[model samples]
Target: MPSRSGPSDAPRWCVLGRVPGGGVARGRVAAVEVDAAGERSAPIPIATAELPAFVAARERSAPRWVWSDTPSWYPRLLEAGVRIERCHDLRLCHAILSRSEAVPDRGPLLAAARWEAGPGAGEGEPAESALFEIETPEDAPGAVPHDLDAALEEFDRQRAALAACVDPGRLGLLVAAESAGALVAAEMAAAGVPWDAAEHDRLLSAALGPRPARGAKPVRLLELAEEVRAALGDPRASLDSPPKLLRALRSAGIDVESTSRWELAEHEHPAIRPLLRYKKLSRLLTAKGWAWIDEWVRDGRYHPVYVPGGVVTGRWASSGGGALQLPRQLRPALRADPGWVLVSADVAQLEPRVLAAMAADGAMAAAGSGRDLYSGLVEQGIVGTRQEAKIAVLGAMYGSTTGDSGRLVPRLRRSFPAAMRLVDTAAAAGEQGGVVSTWLGRSSPRPGDEWEELQARASLPGATSRDESRARRAAREFGRFTRNFVVQGTAAEWALAWLAELRLRLARLPSPTSAESIAPARASGPAFERQPHLVFFLHDEVMVHAPEGQAAAVAAAVRESAEAAGRLLFGSAPVDFPLELRIGERALKE
Candidate 1:
């Protein structure tokens, strides 16, 4: 095994990979250094055990760690009390650059099939499973090998691909932000959200009327069930089964296609209210019930695993614990520790703001100059009310062309044509089986082969009208998807940049004092216990668990980071990314 060597003065990127001797090999690849012949130095191997000290010494130099996956490497380093400043995640970058339209010379990256392997044990997988041991999809290109040589090779390919891009600077920023998001995801899982089990139980009891006996319905649910059955004139109606409930609703003269809450709510029937209530309670019971509490919440912390870049639009998804879908009713359960506070902040109308910047729509940007973008639209006289403004903006992004949303969308197009044209063009591209890229170069996935076949068949010489209609519908559906993908995906990128910058700023904040350390030790281990660390993150919202003394400072950092992220993504663009900040002992309402 190679021994620890002193830190180098020249910039370098360390590629880590497991070796044969139950140890790891650290291969040093030059980040910027080139010899007189303009050739980068070969990788130098270093032992895994000596990584911490070696990394610590090079912390000042800020070498980008080139690793196959962030989860596989960062967690162990964090456990050993080492925090890396920067990294280039090959797996994540490969996924981005390979499909990016900005990278014209993607031949090298596309040929690296091993790097295209779907993420293992991260998104949608159990948290307890070993990170690297999870099975790859059968059809996916082979998993990126976790050897030193492979890491170096992949890094070279990625670097070359980025260098060949038309806009390498923006692309580089996106890859860095994405890799940082991976680190934040792992750290958030380790830190865990401050959860109050007692509060959660109380909320559940209040809503569901106490836990039911085993599989039996609770008292309130039973009463509602009886009411529903009586309304349907069926004593033995099975409310739990959707098919049975639909039949029962029809028999009761309620002409509904399905028992879905929306359709049921449309009709003013005696059973409608109870049915809706029952569905809500049932969803709560199943999604965040007592069993969920026991399994996810431990020692006053809810450790939900966050999957970065889980969605094709670059949005995150939770593998377990329904982290992204946390019900507002259960916000009271997100209580801070005794001496700590929760600083919750979410960007206000992030997607529309992103749209304004991306299109460089001065009028649209002016309409959203302040924090309340919708209200700003109202001030500009673009819409009659804030609600109309919201509907119009959403309608434009989502390809809505019916009812009030459709009516309102045309008004927005008249007011903010630039922004409207951007999404409209994207939608048109999708309808023609084209690809759309986000502001940061995360391209939307191409239409599947089946979709292509449908279009091809529709274009045939003897194609039926029905076939053309089917193709049109499918194209319109996919058009809506791609329409929203650009705005939503760019917004996700902005959020990632915000999170990454905020993580670094929070890390720089002073640690909690001895007297202020009333909270129990975090599962993130000793490294983050006294520090103001990010514990929870959703699409555009983030919650930081911090000492009460640092609450104001943490809030400031959150806002500043949002501004920094906007500037980073859209430099000198007259758009603001404002955040709604809340500092409280509990994440719930007062």
Candidate 2:
């Protein structure tokens, strides 16, 4: 997200932190200006109430604001109608560099472990000083320090580690993209996805036979449960309990190993069909039933907490509201504002394309350059059918070594040796208890001590066969994890880059005028009131809420940014990341 400093206007690095007592009724906030070379000026203290105005004034000369944490700072600025272009989030960068393999030595970063802790590390959050406070939960214990001294020190440490890394350019890009993601997360939370509460209720009612009163089950769910119990020939079966249901199935002569849909599908019993349907509806009722609508949707919007980099693969996770678990059946509730539309887009086979580029497999790249990669493979005789190609590619990346996937993988390796080699090498390293990193340098965690000890015991002269078997099994399981980690992590990096670029491009577009018949989404905060902004993102997919006049422009920006992300990461590789795009009033899949 860092942009170039023009010839006349140089970009300054402004470090923001709390001055002691800044939270008092009439206290001051502290800030210091540091140039790119790390030269700092004298502290400039401003009144807490006037801090937003000061920040707005300083926006004329673009500044990369350095702060301890984005969530701890950016939300308040957003509330004050101030939007920053970019930032260096010390807490996020510290977490990245401390475990990054690109940094040969992370001793200094590891010693500053407080920076790696969650928000609220040392002296409490900057929010406590009223400079960045919001109505969020209290900062967790061991919060990152929010004072000027600590901020400056952590920034210097991150900068130093980045400079000393094996590839500063790549690692730096990762850090910048990650920080941008943190900002996007905060902004998206503020903007909230446009939701139709009435439509949501209608859908839930139709699907589940109306909302139930407190401490009662939905009528439809109860009916389905009874059907399942009846089909199992056990009227007293507790369908909600997994073990009890499994026992009931055995009693009915279904002979299923578990209550999972996969195992159930292998049997032809009457109970299997109703049981699968029951489980599906049960999950929906439990996860996003009427209660969910009441709790998460408000002001005609849904604000789900997005935790960037929450997954080890650098994918996002939700802390509340089950954002990641949104059911497709409820997607129609993801309606846009009256005068706006949603631009929905997602890449086609992201991981395989990343793999091709990362490994520079020209054959694979050529196959996927301008069409469906799986279809291209099928056409090129790599596999007999598109389904086979899908199975093979997934098997290669996920270390699947049984069933149809395993049988089809060898053909892909022969056709796309370089791509297969890349993942194979990663898997081999993982099996030997070595570390593997994504294309952008986010390293995998080291094998646990238990794993190491098991491997060691297996190597002993008189080790039992059980120990050896356990060690081998553990090693293979870890290998599967590492195999997927590299591809999944790099794909995540690509998504982050795409999201950041699209965000910037959307910002450059013109906002809707009063004459355009568009209304401000005030719930989204003032910064994005009438403008096109990202409302939802899940892995490779993104949805933007934009005025009718800007829907075409927003759609184009989405495509262009995706292409830009490909070039930004892979640099002229023939690999293509195609998207399935839709623009409409509702974010419906069809």
Candidate 3:
């Protein structure tokens, strides 16, 4: 998504690519200027050594830089203390347009398999031996083409698809937001979250006792294991082996089908308490233990590799550092630099609010206005308690049809029929193997051929009862997936827009003046070492690392961006998206 340029107000674009016949850092860069009228200027060549300066100069015109992949292009510019205001990431846009149900003509994009390459493997690393050798695909197999010609062709295909797509405005916004997210992901990794190694170690020791010798259990884990063994009267039982543990529990008269926490809690055996505690500690030790610290943290920062749009619903995933699973117990380890503070915030009941806007459900919108949504439900007498309201809302979205959720869900349906009807229709379409789309045009993948075959076979003459059961189960399972996809996917779009808007806001803030009292965090690199920058982002939450004097401004930007995102997507909807915010030296839950 580039910036608007012509009479129709389309985005003006500057396309960049690698020039062949050059070596590594010695390569020449090729660029083209394209107007909204489909006219392109001759390729301009710039020396690799001078590319950063050229880009910095061109940015004054505020053209969206069109490039092959953000990971391949933006990191080098950021490392050089240069930042672009907007970009049209052809690789990411191709992915969205190729699979989008809104696109009337996806044939060209779908056939271009080269553009379907996964995200750049060496995200922060330079394309070749140096940052300027952008066309070298020797390392990344099946990578998106980085040569000038291929990139230009791919951009043309993408723009054509966008022109012919239904509701071009919405899809264009999604593609733009996704591209911005790519830039955000790279910048966050470069800055990293401020980490306190000593604090992390202290927390680890307090929870699991001191770190044990290599290949050995921690002291607390050993004690719990022995206690569980003693309770079962089996000194040699293998607690680590699930089958053996199950047999041991049976011998002790516990007789559980699995060692899962829920099943274990059902039995009152003496071994249960110690065993549960042991499993929890063991998970922490395994996932974020001493080894994790050695690998993920460096120079007082924890750098996680964020894969934007990694999930089918457009949610981000981490390839390294277990970022999505950072436990709350270790949150205190997220300490800001000496002169900086962390501004953290997360949306409250984001999906429900998104659902209210998508359905234009006036009653549901009124229920959640300026208060806790679940509490609002109780005040409106839609449910008897906060807990029931939560269960019913989750049930409605997740297609839950049994137990308390099932029983309470009908109450929500009656009170908010518009919201319920939206999901119910999506679920029915999914059951019949049809496509469903988010509010911003991100569509759900259709069921696979195997599923279609199973349903077809079950409908044929002389089909067995078992066949029909399997078909029904498969349909209902897909129904559940679609029921939640629209809400969750649209919520993810809202988050991306929020991140993009806030990033722009943070950039516009005046850089803090140098003072004797202020200390620099050199680890965050040139682009952010002395300025406020985003450090962390989960699905609905964000943490900005900013100078101590700028913390309040950062907090305001966080809230304001969320409001802008809601309006950008839903357009004057009455639904509210409130945030729970915190500002301090450390990221701690309130």
Best by lDDT: 3
Model 3: how far is 417 from its true place, Å? 0.6
Q: On residues 25-50, what C-alpha lDDT tens digit does candidate 3 reach at each position?
A: 43457889888778798999877667
Model number with the top TM-score: 3
Q: What ranking of all candidate models by lDDT puts the best one first?
A: 3, 2, 1
Candidate 1 vs candidate 2, lDDT winner: 2
Candidate 1's residue-wise lDDT over 1-590, tens digit each?
Answer: 22235544345665555444433123232223322222455544445556566667766777677778876666666666778788878888898999999898888888887777675533233234234332211112355666666776777788788888888998989999999999898888877888999999999999889888887777878888888898889999899899988888898899999988888889998888988898899888888989899899887888887778888999888877889988999998998888889999988899999999999999989888875999988888888999998898898999999999999898888988899899999999999889999998999988999999999999999999999999999999899999999999999999999999999999888777777666654544547756888998888999999988889999999999999999999999999987889999889643
lDDT of prediction 1: 0.82
Which portions of model 2 miss their true places by more than 4 Å?
1-11, 22-28, 118-139, 520-524
The C-alpha RMSD in Å for every predicted model, in order, reads 4.5, 3.1, 2.8
User: What does the lDDT come to for candidate 2?
Assistant: 0.85
Per-candidate clashes, comma-separated: 0, 6, 3
Q: Please give the ranking of all candidate structures by TM-score, highest first, separated by commas.
A: 3, 2, 1
Q: What's the lDDT of the predicted structure labeled candidate 3?
A: 0.87
Q: Model 2, range 1-590, lDDT digits (tens) per residue?
A: 33445542354688888766635533346789887666788888876667678888987687888887887777777888888778888887888899998998899889986777753244232344444433222335777766778888888888888889767989989998998998899899888889898998898888788888997988888888888888887899988888998899899998878888898899998777777887887888888887888899888889888888888899988877899889998899999888889999999999999999999999999889888999999999989999999999999999999999999999989999999999999999999998899988999988999999999999999999999999999999999999999999999999999999999999899867776537755544556657899999999899999988888999999999999999988899888899999999999886
Candidate 3 positional error at 203, Å = 0.6
- Scored against the true structure, residue 330 in model 3 reaches a CA lDDT of 94
